[model samples]
Target chain A: MASGNKTTLLFYPSTTNVSAKIHPVVLFNICDSFVRRPDQAERVIGTLLGSVSADGIVEIKNSYAVPHNESADQVALDIDYHHTMYLSHQKVNPKEVIVGWYSTGSGVSGGSQLIHEFYSREVSNPVHLTVDTGFTNGEASLKCYVSFNLSLGDRQLAAQFQEIPLDLRMIEAERVGFDILKTTVVDKLPNDLEGMEATMKRLLALIDDVYNYVDGVVEGRLIPDNNIGRFISNTLSSLPKISPATFDKVFNDRIQDNYALVYLSSLARTQLSIAEKLNTAAQVL
Target chain B: MANTMARSFLQAVATEEVAPPLRVVQMEGLAVLKIIKHCKEFSPALVTGQLLGLDVGSVLEITNCFPFPTREEDDENEADGANYQLEMMRCLREVNVDNNTVGWYQSTLLGSYQTVELIETFMNYQENIRRCVCIIYDPSRSNQGVLALKALKLTESFMDLYRHNSFIGEKLREKKLSWVDIFEEIPIKVSNSALISAFMTELEPDSPVVQCDLDRLKLSTAPFMERNLEFLIECMDDLSSEQNKFQYYYRNLSRQQAQQQTWLQKRRTENIARKAAGEEPLPEEDPSNPIFKPIPEPSRLDSYLITNQVANYCNQINGAAGQSFSKLYLMKALQDN
Candidate 1:
């Protein structure tokens, strides 16, 4: 849990043919378990967190264990023994455990996109816990971690962690903005998780833009007419996409249709224009 | 003065010794003489003229103290009834002589009996004359006239009661007083004799009027019996029996009507055909077709099926509670296995 010890668990495309096919690679640093119960550990590690073939073959090329004690040369071996004991009691193969982890992580990633879209409005960051490895008793055991942009004075640190994906981290940031719009448009339309997220994102962006524009006007940075026209024009362009004549009717017929995506994009564009005008006025004033 | 002249005229007619002679006198001539003679006080002049054999002026004065007689008193003086009648006629004639010649007669003795006497005498002498009307025209003395008129009506109503009492006596015989009493106490009277006869005919068993009354009474009473009996029978009968009976009766009636209509139509058609062919038509028989049968009662199995379906739906809802995600997934896994 310490900030310095929290390392990023990266799962990029590797050089090996088998590893390249795996879109996500999960690393679990297993040791003697204490906190997690036998059942919880089985559910987390024994099941595929991401992708797994039907035949249940899970290939892990290389796994490293960063031990807290330098004297423990057989740290990987000890971790494997604990993992085998957990899996054996669960009556599942080690391969199935790896595959289950891969599948589960993939599923979580898909779910995070929806969450990302939803909370995009107010969230500074959206961090998802990707299981890099199985739970272990030692401090150095891989556990859940969230990614965030580290701003050090004038420099921006774009860091990705193994536990949390970059897409989910961005989604978490978007979720904060989504929360604001959710308050306004609760009962107006369908709020299936993804649909609500998309709507929230669009609405929050618009509101943020309007807020910036009004701030500029109050500060006497921009002419009132210019600010009003910028807000109005952007609003008008955003309207036709969400209106019944265009996306709404098609969305009502089939919610999974791409109209929602198109509508959200259009709304975002209009909101950005308004936000830029407001930011400009704010800076000028 | 006009009343004084009437008295004088009555006196002259009574003493004339002529046997009810038909006489006519012009009112215009009498009215002029009345104005000339009654220019001064004329009360004593009227009394003296009536007592003596004086051909007094047409105008004579009289007081309002003349004694009004009762009907019973007039009956007692029945021998002088014709003379009294003749005197009243002469007085009426003298009053009628001039349309503008006003007459007045008043008495504190104007009670019910006295009013009856006046009405009887007037009716006796002027029954045939449609224009011989009497008016109690006293606008200023309204209360007095109204009370007297009310008393007079009551006395006349009692007389009618007595008359009806007598008529009932002859018909009812030994039933006597009670019957007569009841008849006399009846609130309404037969103002028109024809209406009475028509009402009585309804009571006569052999009359068509009685049949018409019976028909009306039956029409009114039949619906009450039908509704009550039908309701009782409906409650007693099972649902199936009720439905079957209703369908059977409906079907039977519909079939009968259809048959009758078809027969009539066929006859009409044959008659028209015969007329066109210049020949007589043949006698037709009523068409015979199988009567519509009522639908059979629903089977117990059908009822069972409906009940089972409802029970199954209930069970499905009840069973939904026990299945958790693990159990559901386990079940799916087992099924797949």
Candidate 2:
């Protein structure tokens, strides 16, 4: 398929080409940036930092907004600021580079093409991403587009912005966080006690998995791999060896310390109020 | 340090001494997601919900919302609608959430949201809550790869005209309102709390799934573009007819004004001749004056709405076509290389 030498454009379909890999963190950042701007009408623009792979997977790792409305000069300044920020971030995490740009909402609006053109100058085949911040539904949706300018006869240019697929890649921790976030979507949060119990249950499940593996090997039903043996040893060694009585005492002391801190803060607050009253009285006198 | 900065910033903006230029609508991530869920759940059937939040001056923070149960013949079930909303609010209050009705939400299909039903709903909301907005969620469009969430509110002029129950062109012209000005699209911000931010960070490690998934990235443009083109064609026909209707009214209005002017001139000349001839002038029988006085100018509200809907359709076509064009370009470029 790659070696096809067909020169005619009519027969080639667009399905085989471009795709994108968006890090979960990029979305979290986009949402956070949006949340920071409470004024609803303000247009938020941001640069997406990531790299496009040879196979055309645009991996977007990080993003930050360009604040509220800015003057033309300010927009230039913002681009510079974002460039520097991206450079500094790249120093820390070098895998991601500039892949595209993103904004809030669904389809391309009046000025999207202009913005896409500007981004095109920054990177070849710049991906235009729109994150549906308007959670019209229970999930934030993301749309990626790659724009190209086709020359119609006599130097007339027609720009096309096509939607590309975005794949969200998350680490295990991110998956857990996403699950927790999903739970919040139902607007239900388990109380602290329930949360603690859930955490314990998950921990027990992990232990049960390890227990089964060990039980199988001991019963000669399965041969233990070096990875499993090493994992078991590491887990056993990392286990804390505290007596029940000592553990109980430590937990009680920590709780007492937290209570004391709360009491001291309240005392401080009252003292500050009294001092303020005294200062006002002295001034009146 | 960050917490204190945020706290102080909140304190600084606490007092909204004057009406802010634009009302800020802050929505929690959960609330937004819930709206999307509701919209998707009731696909094809219209879904509506009451926005629960605190409205502090210019800031309308939508902390929560609850969907109105599906009811048959919503117009006849007005009492049922109110009861359902009240029931939901009461439940939210019991849960100690923000229960004030800041606005409402409706799921639209492919930006086909401009309609009489929507306007009526907006009018009702505006009458009760001055700052109420209608969040239009288009699940179908969103499914095509973008989240179609828009916060729209009827402009003050449109609301006033609707309140006066006047759809006359003269009245609308007096207000200097156009179809485009009827509904103002407010920018939307989806916010998460500090806790959620911290949790997102905590979720960053040992994420289990890693795959170069290509299924989502494929550009499937035919059905979407075809649908937009079809809707655009429909809108074009409707728009032309709407224009014709407006033109018919304007033509009649001008003709009426012209006939009245000519009659008044003729009556003045006759009165002068009668005075000169020492005879009482014919009793003023102005057929055009009283008859057309009460005839309110035909309101362009519907036409304006149609025009706006047409523009929306045009935009969809433009975007979808642009996308399909780019896809072809990619294909051609790949083939050439």
lDDT of model 1, residue A268? 38
The sequence of per-residue lDDT tens digits that candidate 2 reaches over residues A1-285 is 122333433233354389987765566556655655535434566788877777767777666555434444333324555665555445334666777788877666656767777777877778888876665454546678877554545564556676777765453213123444432332332322343334345545666787898899999888879898998899677746666677557545544543443444345335434533432232210
Off by over 4 Å in 1: A1-35, A38-49, A52-71, A75-166, A169-236, A241-285, B1-337
Q: What's each prediction's TM-score?
A: 0.18, 0.49
lDDT of 2 at B48: 82
Model 2 bad stretches (over 4 Å): A1-285, B1-17, B74-76, B198-216, B254-277, B283-295, B332-337
Q: Give the per-residue lDDT digits (tens) of candidate 1, residues A1-285.
A: 214454343324231122212211122111111112133322122212233334322232212111111122211113433343333312211222232122112223323333333223323332233332221322122223233344555676444333421221112112112221113122221212333234335445665776787788789996788767786778656643343354435433333222333343345335434532432232210
Q: Model 1 clash tally?
A: 42
TM-score of chain B of each: 0.17, 0.80
